[model samples]
Target: MVVENHVPLQRLNTFGIAARAMRLARVRSDADVLALVRHPDWRWQDTFILGGGSNIVLTGDVRALVLKVEIPGRRLVHEDARGWLVEAGAGERWHDFVAWTLQQGWPGLENLALIPGTVGAAPVQNIGAYGVELQDRFHSLDAIDLETGAPLTLRHEHCAFGYRDSVFKHERPHAGGMGLKGRALITRVRFWLPKRWRVELGYHDLQRKVAETGITEPSPQQVFDWVCQIRRAKLPDPAVLGNAGSFFKNPTVTPEQCADIIGRDPHVVHYPMPDGSVKLAAGWLIDACGWKGKTVGRAGVYEKQALVLVNLGGPTNPCTGGEVMTLARLIQTSVYERFGIRLEPEPVVVG
Candidate 1:
């Protein structure tokens, strides 16, 4: 575990924001993490755990000791008549792992295909797509406590997964006063894929695809391919156009609030939740407020999908985190002013 100095992080993050890590260490195993935590010189230093760097915005040079997780492995740990239990190292690419699971006949994660980032980061954000959240198939995860230098295995209930949130997203003082943000380093993640799998085509795009292709009962690989195609067309490729996928979480509102907004604007897009609340389409709100194709200092709302904020300038002149935040705040203000619902950013912001 060699600690490097002043590592450029422009390519590391999906936003392509120019920044540097003051001190960075690549951790490839549990021993490397233990060694870092047990080291007297580095034990007390502030540290940031980095996975694939797809869900973060670097505002400035990172001052914390950056632990870049590189642990790599994938295997079917257990299989029975009921389902399959698959385990993967935290550093494994999420999309590749999903594809691998499909190839192995573990067909549950097809809806979440094509998402950027590492498997370790999935639980932190409770990443979801097309009505399938990680918690739905999560079995357990192993992580190391940064403060105590002890290992922990957490189950579904222990994670406290919510909409785009988990215990990992908050600090100790927050999250019901027991949050684990920055306090745990995930080593491995295990998924529970049922043997009797069912395809999830609840999203509008997937339904549209089914209508266009006339495939009523699609296989897991077909679903995966469809999701990939939809995402590729809607969201800009991070390699070509720097972005962090969806920029905002779809804000949920009470039924009364939804009715009020509907009364004001009849064309408002919303979905009724199981709990009687209404989930407003944030992208629709932004587009309604005329934000698509808008730019603010090299940062702009994606033309294809208003939910995505992209870097207008290429790698030669990338958008700074400040500019991205500025555009975000402006959109938030507009959406709140127009719809009376405040938009929340989805990505983690750090410096």
Candidate 2:
């Protein structure tokens, strides 16, 4: 119920962008959100929900009342022969939750280990990695309707999950679907980890780990460890180098489009989808454009992985969100000009 003014946000966001929130509140429970919505002085429509701050780019000082979700808890809600239903608070760290599930003998989320952001934010972005997505294990979620202060429990169908997308990502209703965007604040999420656990090593990196370790039938913990190792090696730790993980989502194209791109550059990395579409690696395109280890202002493309954009200026002199976007625009333009595919940024850009 307490709102603070002029909160520093440099460390809150993984990108380490220098910004401030005009008004901020830490949401710890359902009651906290309800109280804020019913507050006569505060308008619910003027609020913004923020979670782990791992997947956002703050363009400037935030004028909206920032609800920094800090709700916490994790427990086994139910169990049956089919699966285990696990629930976690919206604010729980995603990686920690994934590890906790594995330790509890629930193995469905091992491949999603080491991803940034909170559990609540996971569904919002439909976060995926190593061939496993949140939607694969998602059961349901509890959220507060910011407009009416009513509690809501939404299932997978209600979320409309897609590749790095969900109904929560849209601010306006489109295609006969109502968008929750700014009108909802997730409080808790439940996941169903099936008893029939199966390892997902379809990603090239995981396959390589299986090959190198000679552990073809790796356990969940081993998969978790390998994923953590692979991520640590490929991504810059936010604590050390400011970044928002992969800057762009891999673009999916039709078979003909893929063939055209292949004809242009025979070595373009891509994967065929079950739906008959082809997903091109965004990093390879950027690297092929010769952007690796390059910089624009204080923003640079990670030399090891071109999909990631980094803040070259350390904490003492951080890169502004403007600089980051500038670099992203340049990268997008380059890739589009070369391959005729438009690259879309994955992070939610907020000003």
Candidate 3:
């Protein structure tokens, strides 16, 4: 474990917000984590596990001890006629892992290509894209309890995965619930990739790619390339323009509520889920509210995609997390007033 004081975090997070962690610890292995948790001076300190820093907004300097997960490794744990089981250490980049799996003849993770963040954080958010959620391929994960310093192995059902939600995202530890939240730090994740892989071309963008390329039977790498292409066109590169992709979750509503909104606004874009709920396009709603290409202080909505909130001031004078939240609230209020639906932010806000 390497410990540092007053660590600058502007470049650590994709938002490029200028903030500092009073103390930061980089743990390269489970032994490092256990050592820090068992240390007399640091055992009881409030802590935050930081991965790639893609899905967070730092409001100001953080007082909690920051545990920057840096554990690294990837390997094929098992393979059989049924499928392949692969495991990766928590700190591996998500996109790189997806690509590596494809190269290893595992095709199940292609739909989630190009997403930013580390492998460890994927389960916390139940990250999904283009019709595939992490739960669809998740086999199990190993994490350590911060309170007791005990290691835990949880399966798919134990995660309580929902739409961009998991037990890991909750704060309270319910009696029968896996509300891990701040209590657990994931150390590794395992995925079960089935032998029979089918193309998930249900999403409009994927369908468009299939139609344009005239490749009805695309390989996993082909699908991966296409998803990357589509995302690159819609979302801004964090290196150039600071942003946390998809600033808000797409609010789901009942059929009756959907009908009511449709009556008020005929051109609303929405998709009917497998269940009865209707998922409205948050970007479309924000654009409808005239937020695209607009700014509030140093934070602004991305011109290409309103769903993205960007730092307009660049690195020198970057947008603070406060500015981003302020703009988010204003957009939320306008959206609610006009459409009677509330917007929930996707990224975790911290200080």
lDDT against the true structure, each candidate: 0.94, 0.93, 0.93
Backbone collision count in every prediction? Answer: 0, 0, 0
Weakest ten-residue segment in model 3 by summed lDDT: 172-181
Over the stretch 118-168, how does candidate 2's per-residue lDDT look in tens digits? 998999999999898899999999998999988898898888889999889
Instruction: Give lDDT tens digits, candidate 1, residues 1-351.
Output: 689999999988998999999999999999999999999988999999999889899899999999999899999999999999999999999999999999988899999999999999999999999989999999999999988889999898888899999989888644454689999999999999998988888778999999999999999999999999999999999999999999999999999999999999999889888899999889999999999999999999999999999999889999999999999999999998988899999999998
Best by lDDT: 1
**Between the candidate structures 2 and 3, which one is better when assessed by TM-score?**
2
TM-scores vs. true structure, each candidate: 0.98, 0.98, 0.98
Candidate 2 ranges beyond 4 A from true positions: none
Q: Please provide, for model 3 over 1-351, each residue's C-alpha lDDT reduced to its tens digit, 9 standing for 90 to 100.
A: 667999999989999999999999997898988988898888899999899999999999999999998889999999999999999999999999999999988889999999999999999999999999999999999999987889999999888888999999998754357689878999999999999898898888898988898999999999999999999999999999999899999999999998998998889888899998999999999999999999989999999999999999999999989999999999999999888889999999999
- Backbone clashes in model 1, listed as residue pairs: none
- Candidate 1 vs. true structure, TM-score: 0.98
